[model samples]
Target: MARQTSDCPFCAIAGGADAHRVWEDEQVVAFLDTRPLFPGHTLVVPREHVPTLTELPADRLGGFLAAVQRLAGAMEHGFGAAGSLVAVNNRVSQSVPHLHAHVVPRNPKDGLRGFFWPRTRYRDEEHAAETARTLRRALGGSS
Candidate 1:
Protein backbone atom coordinates (compact mmCIF):
# COMPACT_ATOMS: atom_id res chain seq x y z
CA MET A 1 0.00 0.00 0.00
CA ALA A 2 1.24 3.50 -0.76
CA ARG A 3 1.77 5.81 2.19
CA GLN A 4 2.15 9.54 1.79
CA THR A 5 3.12 11.94 4.53
CA SER A 6 2.73 15.70 4.26
CA ASP A 7 6.26 16.35 5.47
CA CYS A 8 8.31 13.96 3.35
CA PRO A 9 9.42 15.71 0.17
CA PHE A 10 9.40 12.47 -1.78
CA CYS A 11 5.92 11.75 -0.58
CA ALA A 12 4.96 15.22 -1.75
CA ILE A 13 6.43 14.51 -5.16
CA ALA A 14 4.73 11.14 -5.26
CA GLY A 15 1.52 12.86 -4.39
CA GLY A 16 1.82 15.11 -7.44
CA ALA A 17 3.98 17.82 -5.97
CA ASP A 18 5.92 20.05 -8.36
CA ALA A 19 9.03 18.28 -9.63
CA HIS A 20 10.91 17.64 -12.81
CA ARG A 21 9.31 14.31 -13.38
CA VAL A 22 10.86 12.10 -16.02
CA TRP A 23 8.66 9.10 -15.54
CA GLU A 24 5.77 8.03 -13.38
CA ASP A 25 3.42 5.11 -13.15
CA GLU A 26 1.39 3.22 -10.61
CA GLN A 27 4.45 1.58 -9.10
CA VAL A 28 7.24 4.14 -9.11
CA VAL A 29 8.32 7.65 -10.06
CA ALA A 30 11.49 9.05 -11.63
CA PHE A 31 12.55 12.66 -11.40
CA LEU A 32 15.59 14.81 -11.85
CA ASP A 33 17.69 15.06 -8.71
CA THR A 34 17.70 18.58 -7.24
CA ARG A 35 21.41 18.25 -6.51
CA PRO A 36 22.58 16.22 -9.43
CA LEU A 37 25.94 14.55 -9.76
CA PHE A 38 25.54 15.15 -13.49
CA PRO A 39 23.09 16.93 -15.73
CA GLY A 40 21.09 13.78 -16.26
CA HIS A 41 21.19 12.43 -12.75
CA THR A 42 17.78 11.13 -11.75
CA LEU A 43 16.17 9.59 -8.70
CA VAL A 44 13.85 6.61 -8.77
CA VAL A 45 11.59 5.79 -5.86
CA PRO A 46 8.65 3.63 -5.03
CA ARG A 47 5.34 5.46 -4.70
CA GLU A 48 4.99 4.06 -1.22
CA HIS A 49 6.80 5.96 1.53
CA VAL A 50 9.25 3.21 2.33
CA PRO A 51 12.19 4.55 4.33
CA THR A 52 14.72 2.00 3.08
CA LEU A 53 15.27 -0.81 0.63
CA THR A 54 14.95 -3.48 3.34
CA GLU A 55 11.59 -2.03 4.26
CA LEU A 56 10.27 -2.25 0.70
CA PRO A 57 8.02 -5.27 0.47
CA ALA A 58 9.51 -8.29 -1.30
CA ASP A 59 6.79 -8.31 -3.95
CA ARG A 60 7.63 -4.71 -4.86
CA LEU A 61 11.40 -5.05 -4.94
CA GLY A 62 11.58 -6.51 -8.45
CA GLY A 63 9.42 -3.80 -9.97
CA PHE A 64 11.30 -1.04 -8.15
CA LEU A 65 14.64 -2.44 -9.30
CA ALA A 66 13.32 -2.76 -12.82
CA ALA A 67 12.31 0.89 -12.71
CA VAL A 68 15.84 1.75 -11.66
CA GLN A 69 17.21 -0.34 -14.52
CA ARG A 70 14.97 1.51 -16.93
CA LEU A 71 16.25 4.82 -15.62
CA ALA A 72 19.86 3.67 -16.08
CA GLY A 73 19.14 2.94 -19.71
CA ALA A 74 17.45 6.30 -20.02
CA MET A 75 20.54 7.99 -18.66
CA GLU A 76 22.61 6.52 -21.47
CA HIS A 77 20.13 7.03 -24.27
CA GLY A 78 18.56 10.27 -23.18
CA PHE A 79 21.70 12.09 -22.13
CA GLY A 80 24.23 10.44 -24.45
CA ALA A 81 26.13 9.12 -21.44
CA ALA A 82 28.54 6.24 -21.88
CA GLY A 83 27.15 4.58 -18.78
CA SER A 84 25.56 5.30 -15.44
CA LEU A 85 26.21 4.80 -11.73
CA VAL A 86 23.26 3.49 -9.76
CA ALA A 87 23.38 3.74 -5.98
CA VAL A 88 21.17 3.51 -2.92
CA ASN A 89 21.95 4.94 0.52
CA ASN A 90 20.13 3.22 3.37
CA ARG A 91 20.85 5.37 6.39
CA VAL A 92 24.39 6.67 6.48
CA SER A 93 24.76 9.75 4.26
CA GLN A 94 21.12 9.44 3.45
CA SER A 95 20.12 13.08 3.16
CA VAL A 96 16.50 12.06 3.36
CA PRO A 97 14.86 9.16 5.14
CA HIS A 98 12.88 8.25 2.01
CA LEU A 99 14.29 5.38 -0.03
CA HIS A 100 15.71 6.52 -3.36
CA ALA A 101 18.06 5.17 -6.00
CA HIS A 102 20.36 7.63 -7.70
CA VAL A 103 21.10 7.15 -11.39
CA VAL A 104 24.00 9.35 -12.34
CA PRO A 105 25.11 9.52 -15.93
CA ARG A 106 28.73 8.56 -16.48
CA ASN A 107 31.34 8.88 -19.18
CA PRO A 108 34.93 7.84 -19.47
CA LYS A 109 37.26 9.55 -16.99
CA ASP A 110 34.35 11.16 -15.21
CA GLY A 111 36.83 11.87 -12.38
CA LEU A 112 34.15 11.13 -9.78
CA ARG A 113 35.61 8.28 -7.82
CA GLY A 114 33.31 5.86 -6.01
CA PHE A 115 31.55 8.06 -3.43
CA PHE A 116 34.66 10.32 -3.60
CA TRP A 117 36.35 8.14 -1.02
CA PRO A 118 40.05 7.40 -1.38
CA ARG A 119 40.52 4.07 -3.11
CA THR A 120 42.52 1.44 -1.27
CA ARG A 121 44.03 -1.85 -2.36
CA TYR A 122 43.89 -5.09 -0.47
CA ARG A 123 47.06 -6.30 1.23
CA ASP A 124 47.34 -9.06 -1.34
CA GLU A 125 45.34 -11.39 -3.60
CA GLU A 126 44.74 -13.69 -0.62
CA HIS A 127 43.32 -10.81 1.34
CA ALA A 128 40.88 -9.93 -1.43
CA ALA A 129 39.84 -13.56 -1.79
CA GLU A 130 39.29 -13.87 1.95
CA THR A 131 37.06 -10.80 1.94
CA ALA A 132 35.00 -12.32 -0.84
CA ARG A 133 34.80 -15.60 1.03
CA THR A 134 33.58 -13.86 4.14
CA LEU A 135 30.83 -12.14 2.18
CA ARG A 136 29.92 -15.40 0.50
CA ARG A 137 29.59 -17.10 3.85
CA ALA A 138 27.43 -14.26 5.10
CA LEU A 139 25.22 -14.79 2.06
CA GLY A 140 24.99 -18.52 2.76
CA GLY A 141 27.42 -19.35 -0.05
CA SER A 142 25.06 -17.93 -2.66
CA SER A 143 28.05 -16.96 -4.76
Candidate 2:
Protein backbone atom coordinates (compact mmCIF):
# COMPACT_ATOMS: atom_id res chain seq x y z
CA MET A 1 0.00 0.00 0.00
CA ALA A 2 1.26 3.51 -0.78
CA ARG A 3 1.76 5.64 2.27
CA GLN A 4 -0.82 8.36 2.82
CA THR A 5 0.48 11.90 3.25
CA SER A 6 -0.72 14.25 5.97
CA ASP A 7 -1.10 17.25 3.64
CA CYS A 8 -2.18 15.94 0.25
CA PRO A 9 -5.58 17.34 -0.76
CA PHE A 10 -6.39 14.25 -2.78
CA CYS A 11 -5.54 12.18 0.28
CA ALA A 12 -7.87 14.33 2.34
CA ILE A 13 -10.64 13.68 -0.14
CA ALA A 14 -9.84 9.98 -0.23
CA GLY A 15 -9.88 10.00 3.55
CA GLY A 16 -13.46 11.30 3.50
CA ALA A 17 -13.05 15.07 3.67
CA ASP A 18 -15.95 16.93 2.03
CA ALA A 19 -15.58 16.54 -1.73
CA HIS A 20 -17.91 16.12 -4.67
CA ARG A 21 -17.27 12.41 -4.87
CA VAL A 22 -18.57 10.77 -8.03
CA TRP A 23 -17.34 7.19 -7.90
CA GLU A 24 -15.36 5.00 -5.49
CA ASP A 25 -14.29 1.45 -4.80
CA GLU A 26 -11.85 -0.20 -2.39
CA GLN A 27 -8.90 0.85 -4.59
CA VAL A 28 -9.96 4.04 -6.35
CA VAL A 29 -12.00 7.20 -6.09
CA ALA A 30 -13.37 9.57 -8.74
CA PHE A 31 -14.45 13.11 -7.99
CA LEU A 32 -15.48 16.28 -9.81
CA ASP A 33 -12.59 18.70 -10.31
CA THR A 34 -13.36 21.98 -8.59
CA ARG A 35 -11.71 23.92 -11.41
CA PRO A 36 -12.78 21.95 -14.44
CA LEU A 37 -12.12 22.17 -18.12
CA PHE A 38 -15.80 21.40 -18.39
CA PRO A 39 -18.66 21.06 -15.97
CA GLY A 40 -18.48 17.28 -15.84
CA HIS A 41 -14.70 17.06 -15.65
CA THR A 42 -13.66 14.32 -13.23
CA LEU A 43 -10.44 13.05 -11.68
CA VAL A 44 -9.92 9.31 -11.22
CA VAL A 45 -7.40 8.52 -8.50
CA PRO A 46 -6.02 5.64 -6.54
CA ARG A 47 -6.85 5.68 -2.83
CA GLU A 48 -3.21 4.95 -2.07
CA HIS A 49 -0.90 7.96 -2.11
CA VAL A 50 1.38 7.44 -5.09
CA PRO A 51 2.83 10.71 -6.45
CA THR A 52 3.03 9.57 -10.05
CA LEU A 53 1.73 6.87 -12.41
CA THR A 54 5.10 5.12 -12.44
CA GLU A 55 4.79 4.77 -8.71
CA LEU A 56 1.43 3.00 -8.91
CA PRO A 57 1.75 -0.72 -8.33
CA ALA A 58 1.24 -2.81 -11.46
CA ASP A 59 -1.61 -4.74 -9.85
CA ARG A 60 -3.51 -1.53 -9.16
CA LEU A 61 -3.12 -0.05 -12.65
CA GLY A 62 -5.80 -2.26 -14.21
CA GLY A 63 -8.38 -1.40 -11.56
CA PHE A 64 -7.51 2.31 -11.71
CA LEU A 65 -7.97 2.36 -15.47
CA ALA A 66 -11.17 0.36 -15.19
CA ALA A 67 -12.54 3.12 -12.99
CA VAL A 68 -11.33 5.72 -15.49
CA GLN A 69 -13.04 3.82 -18.32
CA ARG A 70 -16.33 3.77 -16.44
CA LEU A 71 -16.01 7.49 -15.73
CA ALA A 72 -15.27 8.20 -19.40
CA GLY A 73 -18.42 6.42 -20.45
CA ALA A 74 -20.38 8.27 -17.81
CA MET A 75 -18.92 11.59 -18.98
CA GLU A 76 -20.14 10.91 -22.48
CA HIS A 77 -23.55 9.39 -21.72
CA GLY A 78 -24.46 11.07 -18.47
CA PHE A 79 -23.32 14.56 -19.39
CA GLY A 80 -24.39 14.25 -23.02
CA ALA A 81 -20.84 14.99 -24.07
CA ALA A 82 -19.82 14.02 -27.57
CA GLY A 83 -16.66 12.42 -26.20
CA SER A 84 -14.02 12.67 -23.52
CA LEU A 85 -10.40 13.77 -23.08
CA VAL A 86 -8.64 11.31 -20.80
CA ALA A 87 -5.07 12.04 -19.72
CA VAL A 88 -2.55 11.82 -16.93
CA ASN A 89 0.44 14.00 -16.06
CA ASN A 90 3.42 12.26 -14.52
CA ARG A 91 5.24 15.00 -12.59
CA VAL A 92 4.95 18.00 -14.89
CA SER A 93 1.74 20.07 -14.88
CA GLN A 94 0.45 17.83 -12.15
CA SER A 95 -1.08 20.37 -9.80
CA VAL A 96 -1.74 17.64 -7.28
CA PRO A 97 1.13 15.32 -6.52
CA HIS A 98 -0.88 12.14 -6.73
CA LEU A 99 -1.65 9.57 -9.40
CA HIS A 100 -4.81 10.82 -11.09
CA ALA A 101 -6.29 10.44 -14.53
CA HIS A 102 -8.30 13.35 -15.86
CA VAL A 103 -11.58 12.58 -17.60
CA VAL A 104 -12.86 15.75 -19.25
CA PRO A 105 -16.15 15.74 -21.10
CA ARG A 106 -15.79 17.02 -24.66
CA ASN A 107 -17.99 18.38 -27.40
CA PRO A 108 -17.29 19.17 -31.04
CA LYS A 109 -17.15 22.96 -30.81
CA ASP A 110 -16.63 23.44 -27.11
CA GLY A 111 -13.82 25.91 -27.93
CA LEU A 112 -11.06 23.87 -26.33
CA ARG A 113 -8.73 24.05 -29.31
CA GLY A 114 -5.80 22.15 -27.87
CA PHE A 115 -3.96 21.30 -24.65
CA PHE A 116 -4.15 24.94 -23.61
CA TRP A 117 -6.87 24.30 -21.08
CA PRO A 118 -9.08 27.20 -20.13
CA ARG A 119 -10.99 25.99 -17.10
CA THR A 120 -14.60 26.79 -16.32
CA ARG A 121 -16.60 26.54 -13.13
CA TYR A 122 -19.83 24.82 -12.13
CA ARG A 123 -22.72 27.24 -11.70
CA ASP A 124 -22.98 26.15 -8.07
CA GLU A 125 -22.98 23.18 -5.71
CA GLU A 126 -26.44 22.15 -6.86
CA HIS A 127 -25.13 22.07 -10.39
CA ALA A 128 -22.10 20.10 -9.29
CA ALA A 129 -24.29 17.60 -7.44
CA GLU A 130 -26.59 17.25 -10.40
CA THR A 131 -23.58 16.42 -12.50
CA ALA A 132 -22.34 14.03 -9.84
CA ARG A 133 -25.72 12.31 -9.65
CA THR A 134 -25.74 11.81 -13.37
CA LEU A 135 -22.25 10.30 -13.30
CA ARG A 136 -23.06 8.17 -10.24
CA ARG A 137 -26.10 6.70 -11.96
CA ALA A 138 -24.06 6.04 -15.07
CA LEU A 139 -21.46 4.38 -12.83
CA GLY A 140 -24.28 2.02 -11.62
CA GLY A 141 -24.35 3.40 -8.04
CA SER A 142 -22.62 5.61 -5.45
CA SER A 143 -20.05 2.89 -4.97
Candidate 3:
Protein backbone atom coordinates (compact mmCIF):
# COMPACT_ATOMS: atom_id res chain seq x y z
CA MET A 1 0.00 0.00 0.00
CA ALA A 2 1.22 3.51 -0.77
CA ARG A 3 1.77 5.76 2.21
CA GLN A 4 -1.02 8.27 2.63
CA THR A 5 -0.11 11.93 2.82
CA SER A 6 -1.44 13.96 5.75
CA ASP A 7 -2.11 17.00 3.60
CA CYS A 8 -3.65 15.43 0.50
CA PRO A 9 -7.43 15.68 0.66
CA PHE A 10 -7.90 12.75 -1.68
CA CYS A 11 -5.76 10.65 0.59
CA ALA A 12 -7.88 11.74 3.50
CA ILE A 13 -10.99 10.66 1.58
CA ALA A 14 -9.38 7.32 0.86
CA GLY A 15 -8.68 7.07 4.56
CA GLY A 16 -12.41 7.45 5.28
CA ALA A 17 -12.62 11.20 5.64
CA ASP A 18 -16.00 12.79 5.03
CA ALA A 19 -17.04 12.94 1.39
CA HIS A 20 -20.15 12.40 -0.72
CA ARG A 21 -18.88 9.02 -1.76
CA VAL A 22 -20.60 7.29 -4.65
CA TRP A 23 -18.58 4.12 -5.09
CA GLU A 24 -15.74 2.25 -3.51
CA ASP A 25 -13.82 -1.00 -3.69
CA GLU A 26 -10.43 -2.33 -2.65
CA GLN A 27 -8.79 -0.28 -5.39
CA VAL A 28 -10.72 2.97 -5.85
CA VAL A 29 -13.10 5.53 -4.42
CA ALA A 30 -15.58 7.60 -6.43
CA PHE A 31 -17.27 10.68 -5.10
CA LEU A 32 -18.99 13.89 -6.13
CA ASP A 33 -16.81 16.91 -6.78
CA THR A 34 -17.45 19.72 -4.27
CA ARG A 35 -17.64 22.19 -7.14
CA PRO A 36 -19.09 20.37 -10.10
CA LEU A 37 -19.11 21.39 -13.72
CA PHE A 38 -22.45 19.59 -13.84
CA PRO A 39 -24.74 18.08 -11.24
CA GLY A 40 -23.50 14.56 -11.74
CA HIS A 41 -19.84 15.33 -12.16
CA THR A 42 -17.77 12.89 -10.10
CA LEU A 43 -14.12 12.39 -9.34
CA VAL A 44 -12.61 8.91 -9.25
CA VAL A 45 -9.33 8.19 -7.55
CA PRO A 46 -7.21 5.23 -6.62
CA ARG A 47 -7.34 4.26 -2.96
CA GLU A 48 -3.58 4.45 -2.90
CA HIS A 49 -1.90 7.84 -2.92
CA VAL A 50 -0.56 8.48 -6.38
CA PRO A 51 0.36 12.08 -7.08
CA THR A 52 -0.27 11.89 -10.81
CA LEU A 53 -1.24 9.48 -13.58
CA THR A 54 2.38 8.96 -14.62
CA GLU A 55 3.18 8.01 -11.03
CA LEU A 56 0.36 5.48 -10.78
CA PRO A 57 1.72 1.98 -11.03
CA ALA A 58 1.03 0.08 -14.26
CA ASP A 59 -0.59 -2.76 -12.33
CA ARG A 60 -3.02 -0.32 -10.70
CA LEU A 61 -3.92 1.44 -13.94
CA GLY A 62 -6.31 -1.27 -15.11
CA GLY A 63 -8.45 -1.15 -11.96
CA PHE A 64 -8.45 2.65 -11.80
CA LEU A 65 -9.48 2.94 -15.46
CA ALA A 66 -12.11 0.21 -15.09
CA ALA A 67 -13.74 2.18 -12.29
CA VAL A 68 -13.61 5.33 -14.43
CA GLN A 69 -15.32 3.51 -17.33
CA ARG A 70 -18.03 2.27 -15.00
CA LEU A 71 -18.65 5.77 -13.70
CA ALA A 72 -18.85 7.20 -17.21
CA GLY A 73 -21.61 4.73 -17.99
CA ALA A 74 -23.30 5.56 -14.71
CA MET A 75 -23.25 9.25 -15.58
CA GLU A 76 -25.32 8.47 -18.69
CA HIS A 77 -27.67 5.85 -17.27
CA GLY A 78 -28.08 7.11 -13.73
CA PHE A 79 -27.92 10.83 -14.41
CA GLY A 80 -29.99 10.78 -17.63
CA ALA A 81 -27.19 12.40 -19.55
CA ALA A 82 -26.98 12.11 -23.32
CA GLY A 83 -23.34 11.12 -22.90
CA SER A 84 -20.40 11.64 -20.57
CA LEU A 85 -16.98 13.18 -20.59
CA VAL A 86 -14.04 11.47 -18.92
CA ALA A 87 -10.89 13.48 -18.37
CA VAL A 88 -7.65 13.44 -16.40
CA ASN A 89 -5.41 16.35 -15.58
CA ASN A 90 -1.92 14.96 -15.16
CA ARG A 91 -0.35 18.07 -13.65
CA VAL A 92 -1.66 21.17 -15.41
CA SER A 93 -5.05 22.40 -14.17
CA GLN A 94 -4.99 19.67 -11.57
CA SER A 95 -6.28 21.27 -8.41
CA VAL A 96 -5.19 18.32 -6.29
CA PRO A 97 -1.89 16.58 -6.72
CA HIS A 98 -3.62 13.25 -6.20
CA LEU A 99 -4.61 11.80 -9.56
CA HIS A 100 -8.34 11.76 -10.17
CA ALA A 101 -10.41 11.18 -13.28
CA HIS A 102 -13.32 13.54 -13.71
CA VAL A 103 -16.51 11.94 -15.04
CA VAL A 104 -18.93 14.62 -16.17
CA PRO A 105 -22.42 14.13 -17.53
CA ARG A 106 -22.91 15.76 -20.87
CA ASN A 107 -25.79 16.83 -23.12
CA PRO A 108 -25.88 18.77 -26.36
CA LYS A 109 -25.52 22.54 -25.89
CA ASP A 110 -25.16 22.37 -22.14
CA GLY A 111 -23.47 25.76 -22.55
CA LEU A 112 -20.04 24.36 -21.76
CA ARG A 113 -17.65 25.34 -24.50
CA GLY A 114 -15.99 22.45 -26.28
CA PHE A 115 -12.92 21.34 -24.27
CA PHE A 116 -13.26 24.47 -22.09
CA TRP A 117 -10.54 26.00 -24.23
CA PRO A 118 -10.31 27.71 -27.57
CA ARG A 119 -9.81 25.34 -30.50
CA THR A 120 -7.33 26.08 -33.22
CA ARG A 121 -6.31 24.20 -36.31
CA TYR A 122 -2.70 23.25 -37.01
CA ARG A 123 -0.72 25.76 -39.06
CA ASP A 124 -0.89 23.33 -42.02
CA GLU A 125 -0.64 19.64 -42.98
CA GLU A 126 3.13 19.63 -42.56
CA HIS A 127 2.80 21.16 -39.11
CA ALA A 128 0.28 18.53 -38.08
CA ALA A 129 2.42 15.72 -39.45
CA GLU A 130 5.45 17.05 -37.64
CA THR A 131 3.53 17.10 -34.35
CA ALA A 132 2.39 13.52 -34.85
CA ARG A 133 5.91 12.42 -35.76
CA THR A 134 7.30 13.95 -32.59
CA LEU A 135 4.73 12.19 -30.41
CA ARG A 136 5.28 8.86 -32.19
CA ARG A 137 9.00 9.10 -31.69
CA ALA A 138 8.49 9.88 -27.98
CA LEU A 139 6.38 6.72 -27.75
CA GLY A 140 9.22 4.76 -29.39
CA GLY A 141 7.04 4.03 -32.42
CA SER A 142 7.92 4.43 -36.09
CA SER A 143 6.77 7.80 -37.42
- Please provide TM-scores, in order, for all candidate models, with all chains considered together: 0.78, 0.95, 0.79
Clashes of each: 0, 0, 0
Residue runs of model 3 more than 4 Å from their true location after superposition = 117-143
Candidate 3 clash pair list: none
Question: Which of the numbered candidates is closest to the native, going by highest TM-score?
Answer: 2
lDDT of 1 by residue, 1-143 (tens): 48877789999999899766776779898776666665656788889999999999999999999888877776676556898899999999888798999887789987787667332455555544443343233223332
User: What is the C-alpha lDDT profile of model 2 across 42-126, one tens digit per residue?
Assistant: 9998999999999898999999999999999988988788999999999999999999999999999999987898988999889
Which regions of candidate 2 are displaced past 4 Å? none
C-alpha lDDT of all candidate models, in order: 0.74, 0.90, 0.77
Which regions in candidate 1 have their CA more than 4 angstroms from the true location? 117-143
Q: What C-alpha lDDT does candidate 3 achieve relative to the native structure?
A: 0.77
Better of 2 and 3 by lDDT: 2
List model 3 lDDT by residue over 43-140, tens digit each.
99998888899999999999999988887876676656899889999999999999999887789988778667332455555544454344234323
The superposed Cα distance between candidate 2 and the true structure at residue 103, in angstroms, equals: 0.3
Q: Measured by C-alpha RMSD in angstroms, how accurate is candidate 1?
A: 14.9
lDDT of 2 at 5: 91
